[model samples]
Target: MRQKTQRRWRILRRIDAESRALAETLGIHPVSACVLLNRNLTEPAALQHFLNPSLESLHDPYLMKDMDKAVARLRQAIDGQERVMIHGDYDVDGVAATAMMVRMLSALGVDVTHHIPHRVDEGYGVSAEGIRQAAANGVKLVVTVDCGISAYEEALLARELGLDLIITDHHQPPPAFESQIAYFGAAVAVLNPNRPDCGYPFKGLCGCGVAYKLATALVENLGHPGNALQRAYLDLTALATIADIVPLRDENRAIAQFGLERLSDTKKPGLKALMGVCGIAGKRLSSYHVGFVLGPRLNAAGRLDTAETALNLLLTRDDSEAGRLADALNQLNRERQEEESSTLQDAELMIESGADALGGDILLDSDKALVLASEDWHMGVVGIVASRLAERYVRPTILITMGEDEGKGSGRSIRAFDLKKGLDGCADYLVGYGGHAQAAGLTVTRGQLSQFRARFLQVADEQLGADDLIPVVDIDCELGPRDLTFELVNELRRFEPYGHENPGPVFAIRGAKLLDQCTVGANGKHLKLRVGFWEASYDALWWRKGDNFGRFSRHQLLDLCFSLDINEYQGIPSMQFVVKDVQPS
Candidate 1:
């Protein structure tokens, strides 16, 4: 289906003869081989690991920087019976990481508790208040999960309070601190693969992935089996790994694959209850289920209320408590949906009424980035709005909720722009900021709102070009209607748990006849069509495109790009197309 805004479709080059041979050698389809080759997985070992992920695929946890030190400190805490508090962020990644650390440490008989900060109150990263509370509770050690990379002050505070601090995070660190472990935020150990000096082979671990590493190291250090403990933590690692939107390759992919398998029959009462509430219990789960279905519900706790609720859900062993917590999360998710839609509508209205737009009111015209702020905006939901705006407008988008004297904003960016690095360029305007390249959070004084917007847009203009602004739909391969078969679909299933860099393969078919069309679903918001290639006909669904129902006619010849899918109804399975884009021939 065509829209006013045309997305750039880039088809990857077809695989060569050698790749076809590799496919034969691997006993897989050429399409699967092409997808693997597109990701530059030409080596035999990498291909085998990807095809059949196993415990051997995971790297040694000791490879991460400061892992040994972190493990030793944890041993001391265990042997001496020292009190420990785990400091974690409020998002899905943070909560999962926290839950994993707390559970694993408790299993090892360490005196451990966790603190998940309130989003609106404590904001992101390690908070000084949390450290103070831990000290007040006589906690002698503080371990952070999914946060503390930029907590120089908080780390120092922990030290002054006579508490040993260990920082476990995966966010990009300050450039100057890459080689200088001595300045690792005054913490005894900082375990982040992104650290330049760290020799970890894979650098795309999420917060929970790093925390899992520490857990495994501790298990092996304490003279227990590593793989068994690793398996024990995969469910949480998988949840955070997918939720955090890290690259799904290397060890991250293995964790996701194995984790989804474990999540299917999770023994955790909280996870089981959550899956029941989400209506996904006893079903084969995928990355889609984790990232879209479960992640948001877990995230809703933090976005609308306290993330402690979600953390509590994960930690709870009692079935009744899990049921109550899951129900609470479900309700919070509904509220979150309403708030997100309301905030998104407000941002859209602001853009539509250009007068309300900051930075000289050039939002829809010359501006390369979107910087929107409003006192009426909810601080917790602005990040979701920023994500929608960034994806819809194909620009780096920042949505801020203005406070009395300052504003807290979340920014999401496209491939062309590195959001954290861009924020680094605007450091003069920001009060503080920390996050990944694609997503980040920041603080700015109300006075500097306009200046920060202008500078941010300027940086974007310098970095992005006209082509970079266009969203690219990367087509992995082009195939005929006859190529769509159960075998091919099964092969595609092998690439499950896809996210970020390893998205589901997109396929393109040229000159398919549009046989019939109609709007389906509630409010007639979805487009359903009968698409055919010669005598081969298949049902296709174009979600959220009912507005274009009358745009095409019967027997129309069109080029369609879609992902192949299977629809099962009444114990019958058939091939179908999940349409992406359509163009007239």
Candidate 2:
């Protein structure tokens, strides 16, 4: 029987000989060495650093471009006792950055107020209204985190209002078509690795990571102990680093590595309460917990309510207050999930009813992309829905909420397509747009939506090839049931803090006999399988693959691609196979 969805398996070329040599020298398993080699960590020093990251491995904070200027301005503000305002975005990175800045400044005995813009009302970045409010409050200096590089008008507005502006962001600078040097407009200092003039060695720091660097520099210049601050705040940096979806390599890997260790003992009342609410308290934290468990709860306030709720939670000192705020965020996350599910259903319906519909299978359509809009959809969750649609249909997707005169929306794209460039090509139909290559947001007048949709689809069709539509699973190596041992799985744990550019290694297994299969989970949304190879049997869990349970029978031979992990139950730990894909042998 054929599977409902098609997947492409691209097995990585094995470096078995190199792995054996490296393993002997490094005192590790060949499989672990192979995974490291696959990630291009061939050098001994790089491998050792990756295996055991340390705080000393972090780069100097002053190495970034504009560091001196930003530090000087902040020092002046602190020395003069000027009222400073930290303007932040509404996402997790923004929330974490805002919290870090507020705490860092407060520790220096400087008066700092923060403003997190409402997602619906203020959109993103530094807004003129936010600046005007800061001015009205007699703010002398304004610092932005996670946003502001593209705030050309807002930066000018700060100048007009006689307020100094410092932008600490990780987003790419505004595109410069004609000039060789990137223009950051009129900010006092722009601290961003993506800036053309920036000499930061690692360009993948998240917004909070940049904020952490700024805070570190400020603390050192103030004659305060810097190590204590870094240790105290790395949990926030790690949370933002994972949540921002930035590549986890170089400095980012070190931050995440140290941050995960710090998270289990985080002193923040808010983080403790959040972990408790998420049922992750007292456990060894990882990037997975930050990205999937904690990140969404922090993001819920920004998505469903005002971001200030989340920012306040992080800034609060009272334990009871933290508990209350955590509860509120938990409830909001539930609401967000419901809204996302509903919106996704509506999007699927639209695809099925549209001209490009194909036999009830969204992925079997001729359309290069899916652009959907609904006045009834919630604006906050459209981005997540767009991502879900893009993954399911294997095409770039945009979901919009139509307003009276304008349509606001977000988009998600596959690897072969660059959404930012696609939007650039259709700039005429858009009122405004901003974001990265894989995701973006746009606004257009209702009258221009049809044209924007058509233009976007045209761009995707021109750029995407047939192979681009098929999802590719890159297998690190082929393995057998006999190799699935607790020791090997434990060694794989060195690749902790996996995300973005560094994912958990996937392995392929050939000709395994299906010993047993059954549906599990609350709604039978998952599958539990027993497979045997040679004389060894293993337990496998297939998430969201329960619909295919009937396709396999006892003694059926199958090929599988999976990742290895340790699953614990009733005080017992054992190796578990997480199935990625399966096919008949």
Candidate 3:
């Protein structure tokens, strides 16, 4: 056993008094109050905002940059009875957005057909062939959701074909079109918060969030709040908001909190069946449910076969058919998980062989601009893997699945790096690229892969630093052993639905004793232990921490960082620490 070091408690100098005051005012423990203050919820208004997330508090949908123009164009199409095409990306955000728009238009009695581009054939966004197909099918107006903000070439083609395009996307803009592409207003109206001059109050919206705004603006303008379709689509917006992993803050929090409520009693046959199969029917759902269980199944369709399966499942109205589709999606999710593990192993090996030794600023490349091939690398899971790789490496990472002549790659980045801006720096080597600061996608020619790789590395070298690459854990307060109490734990519940931006609070606990410890789980992969603090002993489990058990010893005093969680096991509810890290005393 390793010896533990004595620990000292610390507090932020500026907020010490304020934290104490907040605890008194809110009737919560001092440590819980400190956690709230640490999250910048110091002001009364901030506390109110966090505690009461209501729809009336939501930001105006029209506050978005392209709202007026996008709404105007959609209204015109509806008024004229023009044939409209809802062209969407294949992921959950895209599918939900497409389904929302389609249902709304169908209710408006407009001729609308939804089209989700196949992952294998069409890749992402509006392709030339996709645009041509829409035109040939008499799609007079094309509204793109969750994608196409960066489709300069494709938008130009739509203009030439006399098709009106309204792009409601959340991806970052390409360099050439970074400054208001105007494909929408000039000929179409493009709605995206990330536009350099968009002037939208919040720029953190996901693609589906933007689509929801578009739908909201359209429905409101048409004076149809009571419309069945308008009401039904809110659940889609909720699913997308949760699936896209956007911060549950500001308007997004309002949407998701209420949206989950809508999902619990959803009237849509497809959603009802999907929820039933996932064993969440009639239960209050949270973002955790969407991210872990539902999102993967919806995404599995695109990863293993065609995203059309997901789109169909979302759009269908038959219980039996929805059940069949849901089962298939569940199976596909299992297949995706298996393939993801295999690819991740190879990626882990490649990174371990010194590629990621820098501990930051990772650059992954091969004969292709990004090597996406692993015999069974399901396309859907690659994005998730790429995101994981980026987070692990603490740098922008591009994971590619090789194509015949070129390759398709997805890029995820850390806060210090703006992935889209970096990709723009290497535009000469890219066939096409676009996405937000943290995540993006691109196509690169085989011949230019070397140049792209070099440029990417150079950009990182110029832009990043040693400190910028390391992970940061921001603590709200330091609590002594005596501070562990059930009341304190229950008081923290005021801040429910914690997620990105408004993360669950982390607290420091000092002078704790490890009463018992053991490596548990299948193959002894996890750490399980009993920790004694205050006058009580509590059970604690740390997933994937078996390898790190060297940091603690039996009956050793130590400092621990963790979040409090209420775990209900076998009808017993108890407070447990979701252990983050441990240090010697």
Candidate 4:
């Protein structure tokens, strides 16, 4: 774990006293006032927009680069009654996007088929074999969501085979690839927010979010703004946006907020049943629900078997089958969790024994470029395990699982390093590699392991600094006992659906007296404490903080940073602080 530091508090300066006056004048809570102050939501209009998140504020879908061409091509295909296939990645984001496209096109009476590439065999995006398969099935046009940005060779092959492709992806492009080669060997409308040529603002949309935009453009162009089928696909957009862990701000924030509303009455049987099984039914499902509950279940099918299971689950309208599939996915999730834990434990053990000896940015090599392989390691769970290892070790962690005659590697990197770029720098040793800066995958020959390790570490040593290896906590503002209130908590809702870049605000409170304390939850994993000044008691719960019991006590003065949350039990609403940290004074 990165060591914690106690520093002098710096209040966010952007918030003037007017926000506080607004809170006081409007009978809003001070906590909400602080939240507003922290996010620099000082302007009345901005505050109003944050408070009233509506679809009207959303940017035009056509603002996306190539959105016009993509919609035009799709309309042409629909008008021509041409066979079109929705090519999607195997992950949750890709699958959800695929489902969204399929639903919309089918509603429009377009002949549409959806195809998800197998993670193990086809890897990601548009594969050569997948294109051939689509052609064999009479698919003349293909729209790829969440992938195909890096499939230059596959796109070339598809063009030769007489297929038309539209690429919609959000991953950063390789320096060498300026534009995505569409299926017809020519660069068609490649809609990627990360492309330098694209001028549309808000570059952090998830693949499914991009797909939803495309669908919206298509529907709007078709002059059907009130199309029920068009709006129904927002739930998929919400699922993918949250699942992909993109920054939930601006357009993404609106999509997630709107999507959650629709998800409450979602038409997808598999999703409804999955939520039921996970016990999130009738509760306010946040981005956390998508990440922890829904995403993993959908991902399990792709990881353990094929993504088709998840795609079918989303597309299937049958209730009984949805129940059965939900059960199967739940079981798969449990099995996956077990595999992840065991693999993580084994990796930890390996590090404990020799990690220190071979330190300087970890390079755990065996016969493969990375030796995450164990008899117990499930291939589907390795990427997550690798990410976890990277988070803990502060290194570019590569988890390799032994495959027949070759080894597959999944890597996760820190902010200072780019995994894909680094892998691209050492492309001679790798057979194939593709991913974003923070996460990537590659295949390496056993003979190239040593050379790859040396090259990777050299790149890290040259680029990274000591501070880059350590995690930094950036607090939004400072607060006192009198500052936290129910009204304040309500105001904080302006920052709802927080993820990635626009994280929920973390506020620091110094010299707070701990009035009461206890451990609760299953396995006593959570810590609860009443903190306050005289006559003011604010309840706080630290999920997964029992491990830090040694540092906390009742009646002790402490400094803490936390975000306010509301807990509704039996229809009674109560406020709670989701504690981020607590340091004894």
Which lDDT values do the candidates have, in the order given? 0.87, 0.86, 0.76, 0.77
The TM-score leader among the candidates is: 1
C-alpha TM-score for every candidate: 0.96, 0.96, 0.88, 0.88
Q: How well does candidate 4 match the true structure in TM-score terms? A: 0.88
Could you tell me which residue pairs clash in candidate 4? 29-487, 29-488, 31-488, 32-488
Q: For model 3, what is the C-alpha lDDT against the true structure? A: 0.76
Best-fitting candidate, scored by lDDT: 1
* Residue 585 of model 3, lDDT score: 64
Q: CA lDDT of 84 in candidate 3?
A: 95
| 1 versus 3: better lDDT goes to | 1
Which residue pairs show collisions in model 1?
1-582
- The sequence of per-residue lDDT tens digits that candidate 2 reaches over residues 175-236 is 75115222344677889988887788889999999999999998889887878887879888
Better of 1 and 4 by lDDT: 1
Clashes of each: 1, 0, 13, 4
- Candidate 1 residues lying further than 4 Å off, grouped into runs, are 1-3, 176-185, 357-360
- List the candidate 2 regions with Cα displacement exceeding 4 Å: 1-4, 177-185, 355-364
